[model samples]
Target: MRTLHIITGLGIGGAEQQLRLMLRHLPTSSSVVTLTNPGPVARGIEADGVPVIHLGMAGNRDLGALPRLTRLVRQGRYDLVHTHLYRACLYGRIAARLAGVRPVIATEHSLGDAQIEGRPLTSGARALYLAGERLGTSTVAVSPSVARRLEEWGVRRSRIHVVPNGIEVARFAFDPAARRAAREQLGLAPDAFVVGGVGRLAVGKRFDRLVRAVAALPDARLLLVGEGDQREELLRTAGECGAADRVLLSGRCEDPPPAGAAPDTLTLPSLLAAMDVFVSTSPDEAFGLAVVEALAAGLPVLYVACPAVDDLPPGSAPGARRIGPSVPELTAALREVRRAGGARLPQPAAVRRYDIAAGARQLMSLYENAVHGTPLPHEVSCS
Candidate 1:
């Protein structure tokens, strides 16, 4: 079957990553369209031989894009139209309906309230989202918590389907030799403690709080990955905390380095494997993709206790250490995790629920059901 996947921008966010992974694995003939200029993810998709379309959307409400998108969808005769992020879901779904595409679907990647822009749910934005949901044949939620938020926001439960985000298990599989090589390549002291945090350097990511916590542990070094507008602000915060030297701000390394190399020099998996501990500071993460990646690399994780992370299996290896909202509590937990020594990391089996291939199969089924007017299979618990 042919499907069209639309998103706002193909940046390196969780939603963007999920979309790329799904596109890579989905069986249908799929094409991705970005409402705005194509970013890094667009390039990645194009490399995989998938066509990437840019609609030249400038702002939130681009009325001009609707007609263009509608014409494109109609011309392509897409059987299913899947949208991700806020703007794409709103405009793309509507455009799909206008184009007479059957089975318009939108995946709610994050909770309604946790949208990047502080637009209130009671505002016009929410109204547009609700309109799209009503027009959509189905809605996909990356996590149960995300689905619950959609329900709370008044979307009918019958239209919502929970599909937890998936990862490429083999891509993130642990490599014992690579781990040691990464440490050696980085010239890290044999006993040195490293805590790695991966995410955009934005306010919501709470990187500042992580810096503060890291400052408290003079012996522990911190690795801040990813790039964003707040990089300068975070660097200043690190300087202010007098931990500038201890903090290694390894800005955005999208591609994992070669095997048996350091992250700054090697791939993401190697970088992750070299870490003694992985920490996610975001308080409102919808699904902890980076934390799971760290776990897959066999590093213990310490994340702020949020509904998204608490959903992981209880007895999973490299068992997660959940802390309160305060920076002090996080600092204490970091110290505790470091002192406790190495623990078994989460195995691929524990995280199979988020497998990209499995997630794509489920999404393909949803698209089929949406087109055939048949009810989707009973919602399976990823837990």
Candidate 2:
């Protein structure tokens, strides 16, 4: 199937990375449209040879780009138009409808009861989202909790499909040499215990708690990867916790190296390699992609709230431990996991369930099912 993917921007975030990973496994013809900020991840998509159409959306209220996007959708003759994130879902759904696209699907990547696109939930936002969501044939949620959240917000249950996020599992497999090199590159002591977190440094993520937690651990250093407006606040928080010297922020790292390209030092996988224990302080995560990535990296994970693992059965991810959202709790969890010498990654069988290729194939099946106006038997979907 020829698919057109639309997203708000190509920044180095979970949804953007997930899109890049899925495209690598998608067998059919595909192209991308970024509404604005065609940043680092855009280069990675281009490196992989996918055509990226940048609709220079000047601001949130730029309605002129709608016609341009609709024109591209019609010209491309794509079989499907899949949207990701909030703005893209709003505009892409409208554009796809204008282009007479039959099956428009959107993956609700970052929404929960608490926050929408890193902002506090509001009735106006809900109304706007529900309005745009009606234009799509299907809405894919990254976890069961998110699927339920969609239904609570007025999306029909049948239209909301639970499709878990996936990653290239083996790409994050444990690598002792890579770990050593990564720590050295970050100017960290070889044996300094590390508690790592990966995500946009936003207020909603509860990174303020993570700073205090890491500070409480006398030997632990906090390595955060990603950039956001919360940097100044987090820096001040670290100082307040007396952990300013122990906190390390790598900013936005390079995208996963493209084929035939040398491995980039500051990439996500490298950050995972350098970490001994991965901590998730997000109090309201719809799905924790980074925690699963930590499992893939063979690091014991301590989470405040992760729908990805919490919504699953016990032992879904071998080393994952859910903890309360507080500094003492996170500090104790980190200490306990570190004492356990870290944990091995989940078995290959477990990893395969969330493989990006599997998710992409499921999406293709959903697209076909939607376009043909009939449900296909045995179609893959996460429970």
Q: State in Å the error of residue 100, model 2.
A: 1.7
RMSD of each: 2.9, 2.0
* Overall lDDT per candidate, in order of appearance: 0.77, 0.85
lDDT tens digits, residue span 1-383, model 1: 88999998986677886787778788889888998868777887787778999889989756988999999999998889999888888888889889988689888876634563323355566776787789887788877777777888789887788777877877777887777887787766657798889988888888888888999999988888788888989889889999888887777765422233443466678778777888888777677778778767777778873444566566653356676767898899988887888554656455666677878777777877878865555653221
Model 2: per-residue Cα lDDT at residue 310: 74
lDDT of 1 at 105: 84
Which tens-of-lDDT digit does each residue in 1-383 have in candidate 2? 78999999998888898898888888878899999999878888988889898999987789999999999999999889999999999999999999999799999999877888778889998999999989998899998899888889888887888778998877888888888888998989998988899989888888889899889988889999989989999999999888999999889765576555665456677889899888888888888888887778877778878888877777677677778997888878887877877345654344557888788778777887877755544644323
Q: Kindly report which residue stretches of model 2 are placed more than 4 angstroms away from their true locations once superposed.
A: 258-264, 342-350, 379-383
Which residue pairs clash in candidate 1? Answer: 166-354, 256-267, 256-268, 257-266, 257-267, 318-344
